[model samples]
Target: MIKIHLSRLLGERRLTQADLARKTGIRPSTIGDYYHELAERINLDHLDLICEVLNCTVSDVLEYIPSHKRKK
Candidate 1:
């Protein structure tokens, strides 16, 4: 599973989605999608903008956690 840390980061900074959207010039809906992990695909350019606004690295925003499969 790909885990997004956007919500956590925002909570740490006490920032709202609109706050980030205004600062990054990104659509509030897009940022909301990411915050809820409901985005099917992410634009790298948008990710870069978000990182810049949050002062965070790509790794800090995203994480890959391998899922465990059931054994027969």
Candidate 2:
């Protein structure tokens, strides 16, 4: 599963979805979807904007764990 750690990063920065949206100029609804890990897909441009705003690398927000590697 590709786990998004956006919620954790936001909490660490004390930033809200609205704050992220405003900073990245991404739609609030889109940010909300990502914030909640409800987004099925993401655009690279949007991801770049988010990383720029958060001052983080892509790996800081996303993690990929193969199914077999996942703990049962």
Candidate 3:
């Protein structure tokens, strides 16, 4: 399963969806969707903006966790 860890990251930074939206020039609704894992896809440009605003790398924002069946 592809999971979004945005909520965790935001919690760690003590930032709200509104804060990120204002910083990234992204809509609050869009940020909310991403926070809730409702976004089907994200643009690379948007990702870059998010990373810059959050002062984090792509890896910090996202991680690939192997499925339980595929885990060693």
Best-to-worst ranking by lDDT: 2, 1, 3
Worst 10 residues of 2 by lDDT: 63-72
Q: Write the per-residue lDDT of candidate 2 for residues 1-72, one digit (tens) a residue.
A: 898899999999999989999999999999888888999998899999999999999999899999998976
Highest TM-score, which number?
Answer: 2
lDDT of 3 by residue, 1-72 (tens): 556678888999999999999999998998898889888887788789989988889888776777984566
lDDT of 1 by residue, 1-72 (tens): 788889999999999999999999889999999999998888999999999999999999998876663222
Ranking by TM-score: 2, 1, 3
Candidate 1: where are CA atoms >4 Å away? 69-72
Query: What lDDT does each candidate get?
Result: 0.91, 0.93, 0.85
Would you give me the overall lDDT of model 1? 0.91
- The local lDDT score (0 to 100) that residue 5 gets in candidate 2 is 91
* Candidate 3 residue-wise lDDT at 31: 87
Give the TM-score (vs. native) of candidate 1. 0.90
